[model samples]
Target: MIVEHAVLRVRPGQAAAFETAMAKARPLVTVQQGFLSIEVRPSCDDPEIYLLLIGWDRIESHRDGFRQSPDYPHWRALLHHFYDPMPVVNYYGRSIFHD
Candidate 1:
């Protein structure tokens, strides 16, 4: 599986709205081809920071497939405006693990 990580730094006081929008956006990604799962978690250390973990069967599904789909625009519209400096998104494949 490939994991896409987006370290979202939402503006202060915007966490609740960001989370609410993501709740609605999550299902859109779930229905896409090669989607495995989606997870969103708030940072304990920094309340304005949120971590998004998305599982995909292949890298292209995230980079090419999802971006090409119509749902992406909707997803962007719902969640893109909350970013403080905008999130940094990157994908990873399993490489090392302790457990």
Candidate 2:
């Protein structure tokens, strides 16, 4: 499996709005092929920072499948504006220590 990670720095005072928009945008990604799950968490130290983790069967499932899909525009429209600077996304493979 692959894990996509992003540290979203939302505009100050817009965390609530961002979270609400994320909730609405969740379904867009969830319906994609190879999508497993997603978790969005707010930072305790920095209110404007959010951690987005999404599980996928492969990296291409996100880089190609979702990003190329028509749903991407809707997802981008809903949440992209809340970001102060664009988020940098990274992908990880399974943990080496995992059984």
Candidate 3:
């Protein structure tokens, strides 16, 4: 599995707007191929920071396939404005972790 982690720092006073946008925007992932699951969590220490965690079957499923789809443009239009300075997205594969 591929793990994609993004830290979204919303602009001040735009938290509600960002959350509402995400509610409408997140479904785009479901329509695409190779989607596993996703989670969005608000930071306890920083209210403006949101943690976006997504799991994909393969890295290409998101990095290549999803970005190439026409829907991404619409997705970008809907959510890109919410970022303060734009979030940095990082990807990783399982190395070692257990519960």
Candidate 4:
């Protein structure tokens, strides 16, 4: 499996709206092929910052499959505007250490 990680920096005072949007946007991504699971968490140090972790079957599942799908636009519309500087997404391979 592959792990997709991104730190979302939301605009000030938009955390609640962003979380609502994310919840609405979840179905768009979850319906894609190769999707595994996703988790979103707010930072303890900074509430404006959120951690987005997604599990996929492969890197292409996100970059090529989901991003290229018809649902992408809806997903973007729902959640993209809340971002300040925008998030930087990265992918990771299987973990070397885990419980």
Per-model clash counts, in order, read 0, 0, 0, 0
Q: Each model's TM-score?
A: 0.93, 0.97, 0.93, 0.97
Least accurate 10 contiguous residues by lDDT in model 1: 89-98
Model 1, position 92, has a per-residue lDDT of: 92
Q: What tens-digit string does per-residue lDDT give for candidate 3 at 44-77?
A: 9988889999899898999898889987887898
What C-alpha lDDT, on a 0 to 100 scale, does residue 37 get in candidate 1? 89
lDDT tens readout by residue for model 1, 1-99: 999999999988999998899989988899999999888888999999989999999999988999899999999999999997987889999869858
lDDT of each: 0.91, 0.96, 0.89, 0.96
For candidate 4, write residues 13-55 as lDDT tens digits: 9999999999999999999999999999999999999999999
What is the C-alpha local distance difference test score of candidate 4? Answer: 0.96
Query: Model 4 shows how many backbone clashes?
Result: 0
Candidate 1 has an lDDT of: 0.91
Candidate 3 scores a C-alpha RMSD against the true structure in Å of: 1.3
